[model samples]
Target: SIPDELQLQILELCDMTTLAAICRTNKEWYAKASPIIWSDIDFVELSGDGAYDDGLIDQQRQFFATCSTRMDERPDFWAALAARVQSLKLTRMPGIAISYKSKAELNDSNDYIFIEIWPRDRRNIYDVIAEFKNLHTLYLFVKDWWEFSSIGESEKAVAHNLEKLTNLKVGGQINQDMMLALLSRPENIQHLSLINLIHSPGQDNGPNPVLFLRSIQKRFTNLKTLHMSKLAELTEDTNITGARWEFDPAAEIDLLEEWADFLRHVSATL
Candidate 1:
């Protein structure tokens, strides 16, 4: 028989399908392969119009349900598997379409259902995340603004406790409080990316650009790579001129100065 260490090394090179096959072969191999299979969980490629396939919806729902629990009541095998996860990626999907309801009625129904179910689902998801004490990387992409806001609200506490995190990428709308929570372990983070960010309408809802830059400059001393796209403060016009929003010349000058100062501070480290 091959040595256990060598077998594990072999399993590490295997893909998910191979790992699954190995797990079904015998108990010893299952023990060795399952952790590797579950270590880097990804749901980012789950994309569709939400009506293309009912099976897809069912599969997604099953995954969420399974992750909702940290397997406290389940067997130790599952708990052990959950603990092995080091990276995770999730993306929000479109709602199911129902033909029985009118457009307005369907939207109203879905809104009510989503409002009720999402919080519970989010809580469960975070509960599992909390179980991942060894988690190092996380990526989340949410297309819906409301869902993004809801996720931000739920992410504060769980994300604050992720001491081992080093890389994080988020694509959605983020508020000031959420940003603060995400940056709680800034000392450990080396890579940060914020993409496709949507601007909140009010000043209170969105992060202040000056303050954000200052935080990046001061807190994230270990940051090596920073990428942000579609950021609101950098692109939004502060002034409304007759029926259109126009960029204020004064604000542009001030923003440029702030960026210059921030860059100067982080130039040595970045």
Candidate 2:
């Protein structure tokens, strides 16, 4: 009883799962809607059992693998899902290892509830990062910082590819090198929310890069909001007069002059 044009429109909005349900209505509908429905998939909540499933994730990877061959684009299937996915909330990792799936329960008030965490294999994230090019906002509920230390050690960090990202909220001591690696990329990141930034001393003889104690404010021109705690070092001065400012005097440095110059630079620019 459906018109051809209207039927096609409906098919465009449905996924493989819903298409299967629609197709059961009639044979003619099945023939017309099958291709569009099969094009992309949503697999975040695959199990009705309400627990993490390693086998299910593997099955999804395999399904995408086969779908990629047919589509002639290795990332087409994942890309489609990524584009559709607005937000993903990663909980603890699956069993037999550290879980990334959230211990928190979902509420109807929250728009973000479910996200896929890294597999038990620490290295699997390299591929995960490569897959989600359209991901703009990421929430990481990580238990271990080491789970992500190697992320940027390669050619570049995942931030390079996620050009659309505007906000990032994370927990843990994200390494300074990794942060710098991301900031170096020419992208306009507006907001960075972090907690527990446990900074270790850097090899640089001067001020450490992580502390933001030096003249590196120029690096984060687009940064607007910063949520953190206990960041300032005692070496940094609160004196607005700029006269009491001191650097390492053993190296024969004029602290006041250098502070004045930096102050002038900041004033002139803003």
Q: How far off is model 2, as Cα RMSD?
A: 13.0
Worst ten-residue run, lDDT, model 1?
A: 93-102
**Alpha-carbon runs more than 4 Å astray in model 2:** 1-75, 91-122, 145-157, 185-187, 199-216, 230-270
What's the TM-score of each model vs. the native? 0.63, 0.42
Distance from true location, Cα of 200 in model 1, Å: 5.3
Per-residue lDDT of candidate 1, residues 113-147 (tens digit): 22123333334344456567678888854333242
RMSD, each candidate, Å?
7.5, 13.0
Worst 10 residues of 2 by lDDT: 91-100
- The backbone clash count of each candidate, in order, is 0, 12
Q: Which candidate is the best by TM-score?
A: 1
- How does each model score on lDDT? 0.56, 0.43
- What lDDT tens digits, residue by residue, belong to model 2 across residues 1-270? 888989899788764557768878888776787555443343543544636564544444344334334334545655564455333333322211222333342222322212233443443332343345555555543323123334443326464566666666554334555455434432355666654333332223322213321344444456556554322333533332221212234321333343345344344323
Candidate 1: residue 175 Cα off by (Å): 3.4
